[model samples]
Every structure is written in structure tokens, then in C-alpha cells.
Target chain A: MMRSDDLVMLYSGPDQVDYAYLSPETAGVYQNKHGSFQHRSLVGKAFGTRIRASNSDGWVDALAPTPELWASAVRHRTQIVHQLDAAVVCFELGVRRSSVCAEAGTGSGAMTGALSRSCGSVHTYEFNEARATAAQGEFERNGLTNVTVRHCDVCEEGFRDLDVDSVDAVFLDLPEPWRALPHALRVAKPGARIATYSPCVEQVHRTRDALSTCLDLRTLEVRQRDFVVKDVLLETGLAPPAKRRKDYQNEDDAPRRYANCAFLAWF
Target chain B: MVDAGDEVVLWTSQGTYLFAEAKVGSTFRWTKRERVRVDALIGAPFGATFEIRGGALVRAAPRGAATTVEDDGERRDNRWLADDNRAQRLDADDLKRMRRDGASGEAIIDALVAGSDTFAHKTQFAQQKWLRRKQNKYLPWVRVLEPRAATIAAAYFSRGNLLPHRVVLRPDTVAQLVARANARDGAKIITVDHSGGVALAAILERIEPSGKALVPHRGPFEALRRCNLTDLDRRVVCFSLDETPPPQGDSLVLVAKTDPIANLDALLPLLCPSAPIVVYSDTVEPLAAAYAHLQASGLATAILLSETWLRDFQVLPNRTHPTMSMSATGGYLLSATKIVVADAA
Candidate 1:
């Protein structure tokens, strides 16, 4: 049974999947299209089980929270790394169970959560104290004990809190990854992989140059293209034989395009 | 493995090539004028360069590294040049012989510049373009890459072969789909992969051992076979499209190149409420219909998003702009969280 402070994905309707923290002490009722249900009612229930409201016909499914769900449901104070870039960074870094990883400039802790899920431990450094504290609380609330959120500027001080040459991988999401290269190198074990994410080529070039001496550098950008699938209905028109009715003639169903650009440098 | 008969990619300055290694004495012709012994590359490291018969050297290009183009600080205003002034001092035969004699790409480019009577008079941009053109022609470097999903997908997409299969999923798209689905350790995921199992392989890579995948397909699992994922096969339960999946709670449902509505309808009941259902298609009509169906039925909620991908290249210092050419359509994604509706009072 789920207990107090357990993070759950509360599903009330097709459009309302909320990431909620279960608290027995405070009276927090989750209201949705169906009805309202108190957090207290959800505490003793098993995950994925439906809970009903006392006053009305409202019900919500308290589902277990996964990293992806948390990422989508979490509050975003900064531009967060979406799943695509995070996965690539993890893969490029060769993050595995038992691998100790390091991250700098933890923007929203989205990647921090992802790393925490995959690796043995993550030492994430965020320059902004407030964000770091907030992330630390979020991690704790989510029961992510594997992650340690530090309110420190890694660019100036480096990952000095960790042992030198102890880290197995490093992920840099900083504006100036080149600045942290020395510290990353110091913390990284021999042949340990490193990955840096940047949107601009100038930053990539700088990072590439900085890593050239010590690491075998390779750079790439991950681009995902999404297509909408529809069944076309052909129809005939009265005007001309050539203008016969076309199948699936929804004018608004035209294919649309969206692109996310994140430059990844791995060595 | 860098075996004698394996197909490898040779990334040169101009473009990438798929080279099949033959016996030791066999010569691999790079071009009509350029050829190298297969033995030269048989045992070499993937990204290392080797000298050929002549002075020409070819390096196996590193994976994901863009072709290097250094911008020299040479300033010139845009000006139209007369065709008559574009005279070359070195003839075609001499240039070909220089390449045959083992001159490097840079050396050949320098010779071309020195041989051009009007080279100095051209604008910096024009000079750079000229150098690029020459370098592409003379550079013999080729980086061999292992045939992973990303490299193979890129090569196939570049060759326009990804269309017939209706699997235009890029590396980024695969990564996004896997992550968004939250396919991790012990997570149960249902995948309908049409991209030659590349998507499935990516999912398996993320969620292994403890995680289970229900893959329903119509034909032989050639894609999965090619990925060398036999080790993870035990964790995967394969079935035909007509077969019913065993009753189990799946945390994620990933649909590609299939009917999203029908698949979701069949699979939604087996998913844990609040499970994410990610649908990918080349077009949007079906997904839009599925979104409407989900909303109308109150089966899912949160943001029902349809995102299209656009990639732009930042060329750095001076030439910072979007690339002139890119794939117009990467694809579209429809992501939503599933919800279970209880009977009203």
C-alpha cells in the first residue's frame, strides 16, 4: 500500500494526469472532471487502484510515478531536458547500475531524476541555491535517495565534494561546458565517458576543442520527426471528373513538423 | 568486428560511403580515379586514417562528427566575377596525378589554389567554397562506423530508403519515444515497432532484464535479429498481430505504423491507469482521430500533444544560420496519459 509522502500519478480524466505527492497530514483533495477525492483516501490504497470521492461520483487512479511521468508532471522552473536528450546523454555516458555519475547546472532536475533511475548514484551540482534546494526536496519527496543535489557552482569550484577520479561518467548541461572540462577530467576515471549538451555550435566548438586533448570527441544533434497517421476518405465532387472526392479529406489533418535541437558532445 | 568481409562506412571530407571489405589483394575503388587495397583497412581502427597506393590518405571518420570546415579570417565583399577570369593553371591530368601520387586532401587543395591564376582575386567566401569543393574531391579519409541503429538509420534515411518502410524515426525520435514511455528496469512496455525493430531495440536497451516487452508483429523479426538483441529476447514476448496478449499490466504503450485507436483500445484496458500511451505516425489524421476518441471516451487526459520536429544548424562565429537543406518531415508524436473512468453514482 502507498504511504504518506509517496509520489503518485493521479489520473482523473483523459486530459488530467497530475503528479501528486500523497500527504496524510494535510488535507489535499484532488479535483477533476469526475469529482474530488482527498489525499487521505489515497494513502492506504494500492497503486493503480481507483479511489472514489465521498461527496460525488469523482474518482482517480493513483498510479506509481516513473521518471518520465515525473518529468512531465513536475513543475518546470527552468528549461528542462526532455526525454530524448536525457536518454542520449545517459546512453553516451554509458550509465549503468553501479556507475557513479556527475551532472552540472541541474536546471529542473529532470535529467537528475533520469540519472538517478539508471545509475548507482548521481552527484548533481546546480549553481542556483533555490533551484538546488527545491530539487533536493523534490528528489526526497519522490524517494530518490540515489541522487544528491548540491547547491554549488561547479564551474568555479568543480566537483570537489566527490573524490578525485572517482566518477564513472559526467554530464554537462552548462552554458560554458568548456569551463568545467578540467574539473570533469579530474573527477572522471580513466576511459570514463563524458557528454555535454548545447544548443549553439559555438559552444559545441569550444567544448570540442577543450575535450580534444584528453578525450576522443564526437558530436551529434538528436532530431525527432513525428507523423500523424490518418485514414483518408475519398469523395467525389460535382464540378469535374478529375476533382472526385478524396478519401480522408480533413483539411486540418495536414502533417505538421516540430524540431528540438540539442548538440551532444561525447568522449 | 573489423572482419575481412564486413561492410563498413568510410566517412570522407566529401561524403560517406558504404565499403565492403574483400580479400587482402582486392582493391576497393573509392572513385573512378581513386582506389585502395582492402588489406589497408582490414585491421585498422575505425577512426584512424591510412595511406593508400599513392600519397593519398584516408581516415575512418568518427561517428556523429560533422565535416570539419575551418573559417579562415579572410575578408572580402560579395562581388560578381567574370567567367573569363576563372582560369586554372593546373590541368585535370596534373590534378589527378597529384591525387594518385598520395598527396593529402589539404595538399591537393593548396596545389589547386596555387595553380589558379585568379585564386587570390576571389572573395574569401568564394575561396573557401573553392577549397571545400577541392577537399571533397581529393580527401580520401573514410571513418568506419559499426552498424548500430543510429548509423544504419542515418545511412538509410540519407539514401531515401526509410520511406518505403514508413519508419522515418530518427535517433532523437527513438530516444524520445523510449524515454517518454518511461521504459526502464522492471517496467512493462508494449511496443508496435515498424522501423525494422530499431525502436524496439532502443526500448530494450533502456529497459532490460527486469522489464518485459510485448512485441506483436506480422512477419519474421528480422529487425530485432539484425540488432543482435538475442540476449534480451527472453525478456521479450513476441506474438502475431491477431494474437491476444496475455493479461498483464503494461506501464507504457508505444504504437508506430499501426492503427493507434485500435491498438490503444485493445491495449488500454491492460495498462495501469495513468500509463502513458505514445503514438508515432508519419501523418497526423489517425492520431488526431485517436486523440478525439480518447477525449470523447474520457480514457486519457493531460496535454494531448502532437509535436513535429525541426532541426537547425548553428554554423558558429560568422555563418550562424539554419542549414540550407534538411528533412522536411521528421514525423509526429502523440503523447497522453491513460485514465480509467469509474461508473458515475
Candidate 2:
């Protein structure tokens, strides 16, 4: 049975999936393309079971939330890091189980969730108060106890709350990552890995310059290309004339492909 | 050469000396006419110019050139060399005597310039080119480099034959693969390496001794053996392909060599949900097939990537571009996270 306050993915179809935190007290109705449902009634139901909406003939499945699901369903209060880039960042930072990691500008808590899942503890700082509070709420609702969200500007004040040279890895996803590099160096232990993500080359250059003295730096841009599968009818020479014509006309159609580029620096 | 016992390439006017040792007091029979002593190079930094016994001077050639000239935003004018027609006045015997007299490379170059009848009429670009050509030939130098994976790969690739045993994995690509695999301390990793253990070396470097690496091989790993990783050997266990132990859950698996798809399938049941699996191949076709298979299985989120590294020579402050020659392709990497999908409704 699904528990109260659990984040669930309400799946109607590929195009109309919704994520909602189950609540027992609030008499709220959640509506989607399928139908409307009382949020209170979703509790105590088994996940992956279809439930009929009270107002319409449509039905929806309440699915459990995975990291990938949460990534796609999370609220985009800020520009969220793509899942591919997040995975690469987590890997480059060497975020392992029981490892201590620090992150700056926890926008949308996208990568924060990944870090919390992979590491022992994550110290994430967000400059905006509202985003930090919202991320904190999300973390609590998702039962992510290993993460600590702080509403402080890490660049101006540095990571003073944490002990010096204590973290195992540091990840920066800020506008001015170069400005926060000194603090990252201060918090990270000797031989600890640091990774920074920026959208432009100029930012990477600045960040690289800032870290050149203390760390062995390597910069790369990771690109992810996704391919989808689709069935194509073979046009055999012995095929029927009409079927052969149809197959020839459909040759131009292909599945959609997605590619995204992310610039990264690690040491 | 800067370090003792390091392998270096000593370039001279006749030809290049391959695999020369950088030992103090060692004498190199540079050419039939010249003999060079290593004592003059022991303490000198790589790329430093020194005068030898002969009138010829040699500069230590670093693996890569250092930035010295600043870009003054001047464009090359090809038409400026149209009217330049001059002949050289300095003979070979004079240069050889000058080298035997222990004249500096700069002094020899100055003499060569003084002897060139057309040196005054040549354009600045042509003059610089001529000076550089002379410096490369007459100013003999040795570039000393530490033997890492990159240098080893480069040496093998430049042999004019692409052998499968020689892993052409670049240093950057190795770093990317390790990172993509999420290798870490205490993690159990399974690898199938045939590129003389280059991949294994990289994995061992990242995971250290805390993690255990299982390499399935029919024979000894020559590349890894050359690395002298005796202390870390305890962490690496070798097994036959058909009789390897089953992997525990939540372990990283890296497949670099033959039959990646088969290896991945055999290891699939052992991986925990969301465990990262990285497969590398020299070509994309195999990885593309692997990607399709993984996608069809409905248990993976596979992403395909190909990394091409471009090194740039920052010649001048304002004139920076990619080096003239570069490796066209390093390799293709396919990274996927294993997932347990619920039964379809």
C-alpha cells in the first residue's frame, strides 16, 4: 500500500504523466488529461494499479518514483541539470556510498537528489531562499535524510559551516564557478576530486585558470545522443507491388533523436 | 633529457635516435661525424639549448613545444617572397668545424644567416621558416617524457599499423571511461581488457587497492605487467571467461574488448538495479548494436558517446588554433544504468 506523503508518478500516458505527493489530510483533487481524483484516496492503494477517476471514464496508474522519474517530474523552479549531465557529474566527482560531497547553486535539486542517492551525505547550498526552502521540502517529502540544504551564498562567505578540508568531492553548477573555487578548495580534502559545469567555454577557461595552481585539471565536453527503436518493413524484391510502393514512401520517416552538450571540468 | 633512466628521442641532422636512455655520462654516437655526451644534458631542462664539442649545438626537444613568441597580429604576405632569389654561401665543412668548436646553436644560426646571400631579401615568414628548419636539423635535442598511457598509445599508433593488441585509448578517453563507470574505492569492478591492460591500469589507478577488479583473461596481461603493479596485484583477480565468479549486486562492470555484448549479457543478472555499465570499442557499429540490444531489453538507459580530443598549440597570445595533426577518433563509449522495470500493464 502506498503511504501518505509519498511521491508518486500518476501515469496517464507518455505525454500526460503527473507527479504528486500523496496527502491524507488535505481534501484536494488532482486533475490531469485522464480525469480528476481526490488526493486523499490515493493512499493505501498498491502502486502500479490503475484507479478510476470519479468525474470521468479515464483511469491512471500510480507508479513509484525512481531517480529518473523524479528527475523528469520535479518542478523546474530553475534550469534543471539534465539527467545525463547529472550522471556524468556524479561519476566524475567520484560520489560513492558513504562519501561526503558538496554542491553549489542547487537549482531544482536535480543533481542534489542524485548526489544524495549515491553519497553518504550531501551539503548543498542555494543562494535563493525560496528555492532552498522548496528544495528542503522536497528532500523531506522524498525521505532523503542524507542531504543538508543551506540558504547561504557560498561564494561570498565560503563553506564556513563545514570543516576545512573535510569533503571528499565538490561539484559546482553556478554562474560564476571561478569565484567559488577557493571555497571548494578549502572544503575539499587533499586529492579529492572537483568538477564544475558551465554552459560556455569562457566560464570553463576561468574556472580552469582558478584551479590550475592547486589541482591537476582536465576539461572535456560530454555529449549524449539517444536513439529510439522503430519497426521498418523490409522491401523485398518479391514483395507485392502495392506493399513495395508503401514501403518506399515510408522510408523517409525515422524515429526522433536527441543530443545535448554539456561542458565539464574535473580535477 | 631531464630525468635519468627515461626514454627519449634525440633528433639530429642525420636522423632521430629512437629509445635512447637519459643517463649521465652516456655517450651517444649521434652520427658518423659527431659524438654527443649526456653530461651536458643531465641538469639542463628539456628544450634548453647547449653547445656541444662540435660547431653544431643541440637543444633539448621537449615532447611538446613551449609558447615563446607572442602573436603581434601580423598577417603573412606570400607575395613578399616573389622577388627573393639568393644562394647559400656557407659550406657543410664550415658548419661541422663550427659545431666541433662548441659554438652555440644561436651562433651557428647567426653564421648561417650571415652566409646566406638572400637572407636580407627574404620575407620575415620565410626567414623564420629557414631558421626553424636549420634549428631542427643542426640544433640537435632530445625530448624526455615519462612513459604513461598516452605516450605508449601514441608510439604504437605511429607505427603505421593499427594492431588490436595495442590499445589506442587516449589518456582523456581513459579518464572519461573511468569516470563514466563510476569507479570508486571499495567498489567491485569487472573488466574485460585486451589492450594490454591499459584499461585495467586506468581502473586500478582510480579505484586503488580498496576496490577489487576481476579481469577475465586466457593469458597474462602484458601491458599491466609492464606497469609493475605488484603491490596492487592482490586486489586484481584473474579468471577464465567461462568460469568467472558471479558478480555481487551494485558493482561496476567495464567491457573494453571482444564480445562486449556477450560479456554484458553474462554479467547482467549479477548487477543491482541502477548499477552503471560502460562498454568501449574502437568502432561504433558494435556499440550501436549493443545499444540497440540494451534498449530492447527494457532494462537500460543507454547513451552513446564518441570522444575526439583536439590539442591546440597556443603559438601566440592572439593566434591559437588546433595543432595541424590529431587523432581522428579515439573510440566509442556506451554507458548505461541497469534498471528493473515493472511488468507492462
Candidate 3:
């Protein structure tokens, strides 16, 4: 494991200037990754040409994706998971700050960031070399010494390196969560919570079917739900709306301010 | 005070102050002889009116004197009219005062209207002002607000699941609900949270249909936010509790888990024992659902939706047409223990 002080070298600071390297050729593959990874931010100017100091204030991630694991995923530019899902997983999945967790398909390292925040350590797997390198750099940048981002793909590589039957939680946000289900079932402690973030219904259905063979899969879908908090006028005749409309147009037209629903499923 | 042919301020139960011109006539006629009735009036200029009743000073009007009325049928017709006049006078005074105080007329109007005592008045004034401002500030002398269906829909969808959180009603809808609640003679108005309770207070501000004002019961909104609230989940927990909690009678509950004004909910519950309610909070997971959910849990119920649901949620173009989402709204008439999902949509 890299030292915590070594992780601070990714930022552009006085000491880590030599290590603050940006390879454009490496950035080629990740140019188009979209799940909230390509948005422009006003806070990106701090990413200078050197390793800078690291701080973990809530505001660090307020504007930009400051969660080190998420940033590692972003650095690789793979299809990263969203923050909401990560927060839900960390807070609701009963994953404590001391638990050991395993995450498959470290595509963008989002789950890795989330797992690192709660558990004592996280063993995450990713296949792409360039993505792994970027993620490693991000991990070092954010001073995350707990997460071990492996270069091998979980399907073929498996969890041979880690202890058997040890992890507390398994979070799968991959394309084929079922492919990793056997690996998860084999290693996931009994009654351990497994959360998967799949967009399409087919993915959810397939994952559920696979998990049911051994696990008491409780299928749950989480959508981004918004609460409209407007001032209630008593004297004037304003109360709850006469109806509750459940459907929404698309995210682009509305821009997610008025309402947001995150369709999610848990196993 | 009962002198015949006296010029007096005939302060009625309503908050209207009519400059009654006095004459030797019947009660109705003589009541108009410069006779000021402090009934049905929204804002009367301080010491503005002098009344003549039966040729004597029957009653006197004081400056900045606030009065209450019994909201009976006699002074009803003039309520709206008197309110309008009072508003107009306020408007006129506001305009002059602004000029005297070296402020812009528009600024004065904005301040006064913004400070309006009621949401209805504020909305009405703002709608006009905003429209005029848009016309003046923008080009083409025209501003067309596209039907914000997409935005409303997005907002609705953003709430993830509506199972356990509190929904804020626009002011007008609350008023209408309060009026309906007032009309209910023996029943209590149940709400989801302290905000709703405040809404109830606003509703019962004038004409509490019930003999006294409708007290509010408070609940939690924090639960709504933190907990993944679902309809089935709400039913499972609230009904399964061994202790049959006290029934909420005719009260409003404004549900906010982290509201600084939790005391508001506390005050209302103490004032009206039966009016306790639950608010769906993002932080506090109150053990109640929307009013409809409560009704389904087998408690006799009346569910009030905020009127602005249409505009705020983008269900209808305006507050006129029936659009989507009303299935959970309107007061529900149901037996306690029988949960029925009414067609609010």
C-alpha cells in the first residue's frame, strides 16, 4: 500500500510538482464518458501541474467530484457511478466505517470512493490499464490508502489475493452484475448487503434472478425523488395539490431542478 | 352608546369599517350613516372613517385599531369588497408614502405587496407586477412563460418516491382546504406536518368553520428525506404499532424533521389535542404517510392538497384545468382501519 503522504503528490503543489504528470494520450479513451463525468466546473483550476495538499472538508467535493475514489474513476474517464448512489450505499446499506468491502467493475472508481469512505478497506477490480493508472493517481491525490484498485478484471482474475469469505458488503454497479454474482456469493459473508446500480429494468431483473439462487435477494429500486418545498399559504387557499403526478419528461428539458427521480434497485 | 340618531362607528364582527352616513331609518339603513363597521375589512387607514348613526356618535373608530368579526352571513357580501377597498387604500397610501419617502413607486409597490399579510394578496400583486416588469424590462414588449411542464415533471420525479415525505401546498389551496374544513361542523382537519398546521392556522385565521380555530398536529419531515419512505412501508409501520396513538381531529401538522419552528407544531398540538399530524421530513422519518395513507390506515380522514400543485408540479397550465396527480388530493371520507386510495389524479 502506498503511504498516505505519497497520495498527496497528485495535486500540483511545491513538493509534488515532479509527480504531477498529465498524459493527454492517456486521456484519449476517456474523452466521452458521460454519467456526470464530462460536466465543466468552476473549481477545476486547482488541478495544477503538481502534487498539492489534501483536505477532506465537505466543500472539497461540493462543486467538483472531490471524493477520491470517484475522482480516480473520473481520471480514468470510465463510465463512473453517481454520487447519490454512492451516498445511499454508504449510508443505507449498513456499511460502517470499520467494515471490509469488495467492489467489482471499478469502471470509474465511484464505488471505490464510497467504500473507502465507510469501510476499513476496499478491494476494487478494474480491467483497463489506462483507467487503472488514472484511478491510482487519483487515489494517491486524495490520500486514500485504504482502497486497493487492482488492475485485473474480477471475472477472470477473481479475488484470489484477498482472504476468503471476509468482506462485509459487495456493491455491483457494472453492466452484467450477474457475471460477478457468483464471485460475490462465494465471498460475500452470509446476510451481507449487496447493492447494484443498474439503469435498465433488464439488468435489474437478471441480477435479481442470479442472486435468488443463494441469497435472499430483496429487490429494491431507488429513483431520484424530489420534494417541492413551497411556502404553504393558509389564509389563501393553497394546500397540497389536488393531485400527485408521477411521470416526468426527460432530464434535459427539466434540467433536474424542479424534480429528480433516481430509479434504483437493491439486492 | 345606544343613543338614537347618533354618529358612531358601527364595528361589526367582520373587520370592515364602513363610513356609514347616519339617518333616522332602520338598522340596515341607519347603520350606513357614516357608520363604520370594522367587519370584513383587510386594511383600514388609521382613524380613516367617521360614522353618523341616528344623528349621534354611536361608535367611534380608532387609529390602528384591530377588530375581529364572527364571519356571519350578514357581513359576508361586503367582505371581499371591503378587503378590496382596504387593499386599494393601502395601495394608494403606499404609493404616496413611497414618493414622500423618496422611494420609487415600483419599489414601494413591491415592498408593500411583498409584505402583504396573506399569500393570496401577495400572489395577486406579484403576478401583476411581474407581468408588468417583464413587459417593461424585456424586448418585444412581450413575455410568454412557456408551460413549465418539463420543470414541474422533473421536480416531481426528483422526489424519488412520494411514500413518506411531506408535500407543501400553495397558499391558495390551503385556504380552500381551510374553508372546507371550516364548513365541517363536527370534524377535525388532519395534516401531515407543522407547516400544514401553520397552513391550517392561516386558513382558520378568519373564518374557522369550526366554533374555534383549528389546531395543528406536528410530525417529522426528516424521516421523509433520510428514510426511503414507501406507501406499503408507511402502512406496515403506523398500523403495526401496538399503542393506538391518539387520533388527530381537526388540526394541521407541518412535517419538517429539522425545522427551526418545531415549536410551532408543539404549540398547535397543545392547543388542539385532536389536531396532531405528521410531516414527511427529509431528515426525520415520521411514522405517517400522506393524508391519504393515514386515511387508508383506517382513520376517518380529510386530505387537503395545496392548490398550487398544478402550477408548482406542472400538472395543469394554470390553476384552472384538471391535469395530473390529484388522485391523492381532496378530502377523503373514509372509515378508520379501511385504507382506500382515492383517484386524486
Candidate 4:
């Protein structure tokens, strides 16, 4: 059951996601492009209820909050890790519920939320004081008690400043991750894994050079392409497709475009 | 650590693997000449490599710590090397004699290198490639991998869906599906696993500590036999698809091998309001139909029908490029949030 002050994700429609903190004290309405519903109206309702707007026909689904949806709907303070990279990184790190993991430069605490959700404890550090404070506050408000956020330059001070002595895995999303390798190694247990995310090849080269002494280092990248599922209806004068006309067809527009095919749904 | 009767994954490479029982008095043969007894691996820790010697398993370096594919030096190229009979001086009788003399695989490789006329002329990468091929042949070694959900999924995935009974999910798809479901922590999950048990095991692996999973046992409950489950893991409640109502759950996951359009009808009623719902399928058309069905029926919101495409890269010094081999489909996932507009929804 969802308690008061719980963070709820409001799904209004396609690509329409909003957040509603069911704060009992704050008597207000959550207004979005899809609709506006009174916070009082949603206070005690079950999470999956579809509530209609008081003044209009607009309605939204009040769904339970999860890290995956939060990442998609979070207001970006910085470029966060998407599901594609996050999935691969977590799998490569072999993260588990018993694993104690740490992360550096917790930008927006997006990946930090995921780590805390997946593992036992998360010691997330950020060099920037503002981001760290905001992340800590967010974690607290979200009831993520298993996470401890710290504001320190991990490259210089290291993770030992916190209570964490050994970790199962550590992820670095810093600009110069090479500078933080020694600190990462200090807290890593035997057979621990480390992951560094770099968009460019030069940073990867520098990081590899710094990590040359480590055993079993692998350099890899993963990509995910989403295909829109739809129905294609021929332009023939027969009865139109049963589904909505807005559903576009999945077309391969590489070589040549077909004229008679009416693509409908873009899922 | 593995115990007797545990099913362990013997991994040599992505392309070479074998699933074997850890019970003693059994033997696995990798090649015509390479075979090892299972007794030595019964109590060994996962991720440790053991070599086959004299038809018995012996401890080798830990898995990946002694990888031979890593080579940086490229001072010499194959420009001066000729693909002729003169490159290797070792004949068939010489190899047989070396084997008869009880030379280890590494020693034989070293002697072969000493006798080769062009071993020094090959590039570092070429030498590493030659060494890997020869080492795997003469001195077979395999890492004893724990049969975790992710590990099992990877093993089956690299095998390219050879078994019809196993789930055809790629590791990427499995990870993403688990992420989308948000089944971590102590959330109650309603899972329908058709990929034997790998799908259910993956979810149960995440909802740790006090988490509970209610699996609809359509047929055989293979998870009990296939996975290394503790007492807590067996807490996964089972119900028939027809007998008991789909247990009310905070999360719902269906890795269906069949069309999901009808299964959704039976499973959607008991899902807790406002929970995440994830449906995975290997093919796209069925999932597309399911997406439309969910949309038309208004049983779901915030639905996104998407698939994951993976491309592997071969990273080596002066040999960095995308791998030549890749699977066309990593698997597809339809992610959405379930909603209720009525009582007990």
C-alpha cells in the first residue's frame, strides 16, 4: 500500500509522464498538459486508479513509483545514464543484492537510484556540492534509506572518508576517471569489478593506460535501437485497418520508399 | 561454492561451453582426446578454472586472470611470413611423441613455437590467436561458473537458442526487463516464465531479502531443479493458471513464448494499482499486437513498445573494431504501468 508522502508517477498518455508527491499536508492539485486533479482526490485511492480532472474530461493513471520510470521522467540537471548503458553496466559489474557498490560524480543521482534499488548499500559521491545535496534530499524524500550521499572529490579524498571499507563494485562517471582509479582500488574487494563510462576514445585510452596493471580488464560498448511497432495498410480502397488510423507502420526507409503502404502506429 | 549434484556451467569461451553436473563418477569430454572427471569440481569455488590432466580436473589459474587474448605488442607483422609447409617443422609423429611423453599443453605449445620457422614473424595478435587455438586443443581448461540467472541466460544466449525448452532472452534484454519491472527490494512479483526457469530466476534474484514471487506454474516447475535455490528462493509461491487467481502483486512480468494477448487478460486483474508491468517476447509482431490490445482496452498507461539491439566490439591494440558476428535481435520488451479505474483494481 502507498503511504502519504510517497512519490507517485502520473502517466497521462503517450510520452506524458508527471510526478505527484502525495503529500497529505500540501492540499493542492497536480496540473499537467493532460489534466489537473486535486491532490485531495488522490490521497487514499489505490495506486492504479484512473482519476479524472475535476473541471474537464482529462484523466491520468496514478501508478506506483519505480526507478526506471523516475529516470525517464526526471528533470535533467545533467546527462544521465540511459537504460541501454545502465543495463549493460550493471550486468557487467555483476551487481547483486548482497553487493555493496559505490559510484563517483553522481550526476542527478539517476544511476545512483538504480544502484541503490538493485544492491544492498550505495555510497554515492559527487564532487559538486549542489548536486550532492540535491541528490541526498531526493533520496530522503523518496524513502531511499539505504543510500548515503557524500560531497567530496573522490579522485583526491577517496571513498574511505565514508563508512565503506570494501565494495563489490565501483562505477565512475567522472571527466577524468583515471585520476580516481587508485581511490577506487582502495575500497574494492578481491575479485571486485570496476566500470568507467566514456563517450570518447581518448578518455578510454587514458583510463586504459591507468588501468593497465589491473587483471581481466575489458573494453566494450553496447547500443540499443528501439523499433516502432505499427501496422501497414495498403492504399487500396478496401476497408481501412481496424486499429486507430494514427498507428503508423514499421517501414524500412533505407533503400526506397514504397508509395501504396500506409504506415499507421508508431509504438 | 558448488556442491555435489549442482549443475555448473563449464565455460571456455563464448563459443565453447558445456553444462554439466558436479556429481562425482561422471566425466565430460570436450574433444576426441580431451576429457575430465567431475570429482575435482564438486567443491571448487565458482569462477575458478581447472585443467584436464590424465582424465582428471586440476586447478589452474582463476578464470580470466590468465587470459591469453590480451596482446599489445605489434612490432612484427605477417608481411615476411609465408603460408607454406616450411612454417612449422613439427610433424604428426612429433606431436604424438610429445603427448606420449606426458608434456603439458603449455610445454607442447612452447616446443611448437621453438620449432616453428615463422612463429617470431607473426604479429602479437596473430601469436596470441595461434596460442589460444593450440592451448584449447591440447590443454583444455574451463571455468566453473555459478548457475546464476544472468550466467545461465548468457550461456544459453551465446548458444544461439539451440534448445527449444530454454528461454531465448539475451542478457541485455533480461537486464532491461528486470530494470523496467522494478522488482528489486521486497516487492511482490507475479511472474510467468516460459523460458524454462531462467526468466523467473532472474526476477527472484533481484527481489532479495524479503521479496516474494508468485509464479504461475503452467507445467513443470523446472526452477526447482535447474536453479541453485536456497530456502528463501523456494518461497516463490506457485499457482495454476486456471486454479488459483493470479496472486495480487506489486509487479507483473510475463516472458511468454506464446502470444501474450490472452495471458494479459488473466494476469492483469490482480496486479496492485499503479504497478509497473513488463511483457517480453522474442518476436516483434505478437508484442506489437499485445501493445495495441493493451492500448485499446485501456488496461495500461505509459506504454512503450521497444526492442534492444546489441553490437559487440572487439577491442585490442591496433585491432579495435566492431565484432564481425552479432545477433540480429537482442529481444523485445513492452513496458508500461498498470492502472485501475475501479474498486480493487
lDDT of 2 by residue, B309-332 (tens): 434222222333344665666677
Tens-digit per-residue lDDT, B1-345, candidate 1: 456765555445555545444356666666676566666666665445443435234334332333454456666553655577447878879977985687766787888888887778776656666766665566544555544445554554554463585576755566567666777777778777767666766666667657777776543444455444445557677755454555454555554666888888877777766667787777777777877787687666553445535454544346556667766666667787666544443
- Fnat of candidate 4 is 0.63
Cα lDDT tens digits, model 3, B1-345, are 113322223322222222222334433332333322223221222122333323333323321121122232331222343354344334657556665677643465556546554424334334443434422321111111111111122222333245334354333233233333321223344443433233333322222123233223223323222122124222212211122454434434333334413423343323232132323332322222343345343322222222111211111112322224432331211111111221111
Q: For model 4, how does the per-residue alpha-carbon lDDT over A7-94 read when each residue is reduced to its tens digit?
A: 8887775356778787657776888865677777777788878888877878877777777667767777788876556766776676
Model 1, chain A: how large is the TM-score?
0.83
Error of 4 at A24 (Å): 5.6
DockQ class, candidate 2: incorrect
TM-score of 1: 0.76
TM-score of each: 0.76, 0.60, 0.34, 0.86
DockQ of 3: 0.01
All candidates: CA RMSD (Å): 6.6, 8.5, 29.8, 6.2
* Per-chain TM-score of candidate 3, chain B: 0.25
Docking class of 3: incorrect
Q: Write the per-residue lDDT of candidate 3 for residues A1-267, one digit (tens) a residue.
A: 112122211211111111222232333111111211111221223221111112211111111122422343344366566543454455435454446888877776766766675567888877888777777777777667888888877766576577667887888767787787788777877546677767665676667667654322333322232232222333435686566643444332221321212233444
lDDT of 4: 0.74
Off by over 4 Å in 4: A1-4, A162-165, A213-216, A236-267, B1-7, B13-15, B20-26, B32-34, B38-45, B62-97, B114-120, B218-226, B242-246, B342-345
